[model samples]
Each structure stands twice: as structure tokens, then as C-alpha cells.
Target: MLIKTFENKRIGIDELTGQVISGVTFLNCDFSKVDLSETEFVDCIFYDSDRQLGCNFRSAKMKGASFKRCDLSVCAFNFVSALGLEISECKAQGADFSSASFMNVISHKSWFCSAYINKSNLAYTNFSKVNLERCELWDNRWTGANVTGASFSGSDLSGGEFNSFDWQSADFTGCDLTDSELGDLDIRTVNLEGVKVSRDQMSELASRLGINVLG
Candidate 1:
């Protein structure tokens, strides 16, 4: 299949499944509602695209790219490298990002329900209003990441670092935080009413609750 460069093109509802777009660049293209399932994008770049719904970028490189408002649901991004990328308002439910690296990425309002993102680097990322229900985030680094209004219901966040980040209004309902680092963090507005906490974490929460602990 001959790979084409749709740079600055306005294409909608196109089917680009099972195609090999290695080293292709789509600069400022409009691929709204395009079905790109099982497509391989090695070293591809997508700059300033408006992809609204039902677009698949399964198992793609996606490094150094900027995707805005792209609907990347059910996409398999296993072993994909999405370093230095900026994605906003993207719906990526059921996306497989297992063993993927998201270094220095800024994403907001992205939905990642049931996504496999084990051992991913989510440091300094803004995940406000993102839904990460039932996602695998074990051993991930979330240092200085903002998770305001994000939902992690039924997700595994064990051994992850949440250093000095604001988790206000973030839902961790029924999620495991065992061996997770949450020390000296400001979680004032986050709802931890019925969430499970370790003994050390309980002490920390008790300290925040103004319980006088006399040494």
C-alpha cells in the first residue's frame, strides 16, 4: 500500500485500517471520525489535528506528536512511545498502552477507561477531568502530575509515586494504593471518604484531620 501524506488536508470519515504508514506526517490535518484500526505508524507525526470520534492509532510510535481532541478509543498502543506529546480532550477508552512511555506529556480531559498502562511515565502530566477507570498503572511515576477531577475507580495504582501533586476532586473509589507514595501531599479537596488507606497513610490522614498525636 502506498502511504500518502495528507498534510493540512480536510478528510472526514475515511477508513484507513490495516495500512502501514511508516514515517508519515500529517500536519494540521482533519481526520475526524476516521477508522485507522491496526495501522502501524512508525516515526509518524500528527500536528494539530481535529479527530473527534472513532479513530484508531493502535500500536503506533506517536512520538513527539501533538494531538488535540482526537477520539482514540479501543486503540492498541502497546509498546508505543509517545514521548514529549501534548494531547487534550481525547477519548481513549480501552486503549492498550502497556509498556508505553509517555515522558513529558501534557494531557487534559482524556478518557482512558480500562486502558493498560503499566509502568508508564506520567510525570508532570495534567490529567484533569480524565477517566482512568480499571486502568493498570502499576509502578508508574506520577510526580507533580495534576489529577484534578480524574476518576480512577477500580484501577490498580500500586507502587506509583504521587509526589507533591494536587489531587483535588480526584476519585480513587475502590482502587488500591498499597505501597503507593502519598507523603506530604495536599489532598484537601480530594474525596477519600470510603477509600482504603494503609496504616502509615491513615496516620498521615489523621494528621491532616487535626488529630493531636502526642509523642
Candidate 2:
């Protein structure tokens, strides 16, 4: 069956759970407050090149929603309840995720975040002040992405490309950073306590601090 296509329209569907939507085009559509739990969107286009805009997903309930090989560039995901959201091999550059919560709260002080955003392009995306602890965020491009005050503690960030990224602005303690490109990541300045890195990466980081590893 062919996938449905939507363009420049306001989507009124409230529930789209457990559906496989492939090769769909949602140009400048409004999906605010829509429940998309466990929905799989493959090879979809959410960005509009002519209008230079993307689909709006503000306040959307997106638990366990999977987006693979999709174009979600410049999309707005503000205030989204996105627990267990998985986005793989997607172009999500300049997307706004500021206020998006991937947490499942048990109490006021007890909460956990779950999301897998791997092998994607997240360059120039906004993730300021977001708490993404213990999430799977590996092998993504994060160049010029805004992560100020964001906590990525205990997350897997292996094989990521972080050119022009400010590591000091975010908390990456206890993160797995093996085989990732660590651009301008100063070990003397950034707190990497319990963060995993390869021996070659450690030597490279130490060399940046003017330390000679003769071994």
C-alpha cells in the first residue's frame, strides 16, 4: 500500500498509534497535541523546501514513535512528551526540541528519560536546558547544536561528530564517547568524570592539554 501524503495542511487526527507510515510527505503541517505512540514513520518528509519550514509537533504525545530515514529539518518539537522516541538516520538539522520531555515521572523527584536518537543529523538543533540523561544518542552529528544547560549524563554518545560544539555548556558526565570525534573537547575544562573514551581519544585529549604521553 502507498503511504499518504499531506502538505500545508492542519492535521486533525488525534490518535495515530502503532501505524507504519512510510514515504509520507507532511510539508508545513500542524500536528500539535497529536498522540503518535508507537507509530513508525519511515522515509518521510516533514520539511518544506519552498517555504523553508517544517511540520509542527508542539505538545505532541510521541511516546515510542520511531522515525527512520526521515527529513525533519527545522521542525518544532517544543513541549513534546517524547518518552522512548527513536529517530535514526534522519536529517533533523535546526530542529527545536527545547521543552521536549522524554521523562517518565514516578514522583516529584523520581523520573527517568528514555530516547534513542542515533545516526542522525542534529546540527544547529536547539536542546537547551533539556534533561536527556541515560538516553541512547550515539553516532549523530551535533555541529553547532545548542545544548546549554542540557544534561546528557549516563548517555551513550559513541561515534558522534561534534564539530563546533560547546561541551562545557552541557553535562556529559558518565557518557560513553568511544570512537567519537571530539572537536575542541578540553579535558582540563570539561568535566568527564566516569565518561568512557578510547585510549587514542584519551591521548588526543591529553595532548590538547599539553601533556606528553610517551608510551
Point out where model 2 deviates above 4 Å: 1-4
Whole-model lDDT for model 1 versus the true structure? Answer: 0.55
Name the lDDT of candidate 2: 0.94
Question: What RMSD value applies to candidate 1?
Answer: 11.2
For 5-109, candidate 1 gives per-residue lDDT tens digits of: 655565444345445555555655554344443444454545324452233343444544443344344344454445434443344443344544454335774
Top-lDDT candidate index = 2
